[model samples]
Target: MHTTTKTSPIETKDLVQKTVFPILFSISFAHLLNDLIQAIIPSVYPILKENYHLSFSEIGLITFAFQLTASLFQPFVGYYTDKYPQPFSQIYGMLFSLAGIIALSFADNFYMILISVMLIGTGSSIFHPESARVSYLASGGKRGLAQSIFQVGGNFGTALGPLLVALIVVPNSQKYILWFIIAAIIGLGIISKIAFWYRDHLVLRTNQKKEIVAYHDLSKGKVNWAIAILLIVIFSKFFYSACLSTYYTFYVIDKFHLTIKQAQFHMFIYLIAYAAGTILGGPLGDKIGRKYVIWFSVFGATPFALLLPYVSLFWTDVLMVVIGIIISSAFPAILVYAQELLPKKLGMVSGLFYGFAFGMGALGSAFLGKLADVTSIQYVYQVCSFLPIIGAICYFLPNLKKK
Candidate 1:
């Protein structure tokens, strides 16, 4: 008699609807669009190079333009988004990104492409801070899960970008630029509507109403260890980004002698693994501890990265996928760790983590590219393997106790 009634299982679908799904969906969609814009360029780089007779260094420079702009502006964007209540900043950022894509459609020379890439970077830069701030605020107790969802969106975008370009542009390469413009216009419409609706319904506290914390307050001695850890994370990210930017494309082409389309498909495997890792990593980090999760992830990636150059095409692809997953898993943990490191100054800490780390990584692309120029691309891959080892060492550094 006391056994009585059973409560209906909390409908997973219903819970998702009520909780974090919308935020995840919105951020994911935005990330997907942003990544798609960048993804197209790399996928079709071969075409661009052939058409324009561009050098490897020139191609590297073009890619740098996109990342440099995004990296440099990250702190400024993160600061203001945290301070400002208006959603229009994010919306306008999307609009500017679309404009950059549209401009790319008409680009006939390196300068024009550079301008377009810069515009796209400017637009893309705004999303991370604003979307991250929104996701964090919306997350309530489940910040790790929420961040994972946001990150998955980005991973999906990264995965899909090259695939999309391969499918659309590989056959009729001349039409690729036009397709980018069309996609931009469509994405802009969708983002504009959603942003306006979000602004209308959501009421936010003003900057005056919010308590302010200075950077110096958060950057004291206790947090220096955390900063050092984050620097290691940055180094790892640099290697990761460098590989994603250059080696992923080149490796497949060089090792297998595959066509652009074939190479892109293989790249998809790496991205798919990466996306899965990013999605799963955050929740796992919460379950265990962020520090432990990061340490394991960094350590796990090292073997796969080191072995990547020695394997055949099929096995190398498999190792790359595994490497992607391992690396991706560490990022959310790193982000959360940085946030915890400076609880009072979330915005500033986030700004430094997102801006400086990524910007420095973007700068690393040039360094890696030069290394590729001097030695071989395989050496670049081998050099990248050391980053995680360094990260692992930093993570285990006994003096750096978590505050």
Candidate 2:
């Protein structure tokens, strides 16, 4: 009887270390809905450009406005939430997105579109940091796998957006964006459930007075330098990604002489490959090392990206898929690596990385848009093809894995 009693605590501890897949998958589903609604913004950009008769520069500004709001407030939100966690905060984000969708569906002018996208971006800022925290909390020591599942949801959401837009909104008018509100409504319910679980989990954690600490041998200076290197890698990856996500549809249309719907379908294929890569990156990082995955994911795509500009139409599609998979794999590994670097500061670290990523994407979209206007979409690809070379710096990042 004494032995049974003594083993109970050890058993409980073991259970705590086991991955909580139900929570992980539930939160992932919520992430899917949240990002699906957010994806509506960029998915409809071509439509917005045509309807408003806007210039490429104006389209860039719209991306700038959306991503600026999305990027600027995330770190603060994460910082605040780190000190004072909010279980239901994602629900608030959903409401903002709902409002944004309604506003966007009716928007007849460029300024209105900007306002709508900003609102949606604000919701994104709130959703990501907190949701990432939730993933961390529920990870049960499988941090890489947890982050991958969380990220894959968002990637799938992002991929689905263009396909849905091509089917629903592309054939019709902009007012069809209202259909996205259904997703927002569904997200609210899922998030609320997750919030209840998070609240209970927090209470349990507080009661137990248990904390998780990840110790590494690296110095603070080395950690900071490593972080900077990761950010630079993020800048390279997303800057190049922005060229495709924001302008690839147009690029394909111009280069292949395809219709907008056909172009979106091509973009959908790339995004689907991106989602598939995201699925691979996280678990592979757990098995191998994040540094290795980061090194390969970014630099490995360089050859494909450099060749994409000169490829035939069929080859361009194939190259885009290859580049998407290779490059997209880096983010989950990079993010999980950062989280491991600053394990205690989960919210702040998550926010900072996500915020910086969005900032880079915004800058890339705006810069590439203007560049596309100045030269041509094909030229933008030629310039961006070199960005992935920046991944070679991954050599400097210290491996967090123990021997």
Candidate 3:
């Protein structure tokens, strides 16, 4: 007679430190690289507009192409990463990103520019699934803090990318594209070494068969109420993030009547505060639980966002820093929450929360821009304030518990 035995899930403390740490580091660094591309363009849009004589709609289309690719490709990548070895996917993605950056340097027409952006978007899409899956599997049960650290790296990149562009690319935009190519070459060398090391250490047992799962297997009725709640939270956060990413710099310059340098100073302060918030939010979520951290952030952020449109120039800068901290804090908590709700589907969950929410936010950007055109830009802030208020209300919904 044969008996089947069920294996228990691994304990959090029993996780391998070597595998966990490196996976986290790699994902975080990859995030930084991906975001560096995103950050540079917005800061230098004025330069691009002047050089190309582009319309606002044309610029919006460029952003739309970049975001739409990342958004739509996420599920496909998530499905494949689950069933395949992921190290090569990440390396290849970075290579594609590098190619895109190089292409951007020599892009003469709008079509070439859109092609470059699409390549970058394709590269970025690959990273979300591959890195996120590895990080979740490696982290065992201490997933929240682990995910947080990974996210903070991207936030740090988002903060630093603009500053780096300001210092380097702004002076000579064409020359900086070469810098991306050089960086790509260096990245290829590093990735090759890492891949070789990973392969050397890999142990495949003759007796053990690899398990392959389909996307439908992962998605069937595994939906938790917590996930639905978390999606709403993500939707709300994306609205604010879209405003900040696409229009905040422009808004600050126009609304407050400040020079470029003055607006940039405010942008830097807000970015720093945002980065700090992400860093702190993760550990706090792990300590206090995702529910509390998320709610607190939304509640805290709403008033500050409301105050943003009404304050004086100096006070608005201070208000933005405060609002940045509050909104940024909620993101890591949301990421962790979604991952927890879908442990077996980390890549899809992360992709849904991060990629979909971001895409939706990018879509929202066009709507907000139109709102800014018809109504006052201050009304955009009014719309921003409502998102968190709705998020906070949803956060308290009874269905949020695991069901």
Indicate which candidate wins on lDDT.
2
Candidate number achieving the greatest TM-score relative to the actual structure: 2
Candidate 2, poorest ten consecutive residues by summed lDDT: 1-10
Flag the better candidate by lDDT, 1 or 2: 2
Clashing pairs in 1: none
lDDT of each: 0.69, 0.89, 0.67
- Full ranking by TM-score: 2, 1, 3
Compose the digit string of candidate 2's lDDT tens values, residues 98-133: 999999999999889999999999999999999998
* Candidates arranged by lDDT, highest first: 2, 1, 3
Query: Model 1 segments beyond 4 Å from truth?
Result: 1-18, 193-219, 394-403
Residue 161's C-alpha lDDT in candidate 2? 92
For candidate 2, the lDDT comes to 0.89
Clashing pairs for model 3 are none
- Give me the displacement of residue 317 in model 1, in angstroms: 1.3
Each prediction's TM-score versus the true structure:
0.86, 0.96, 0.84
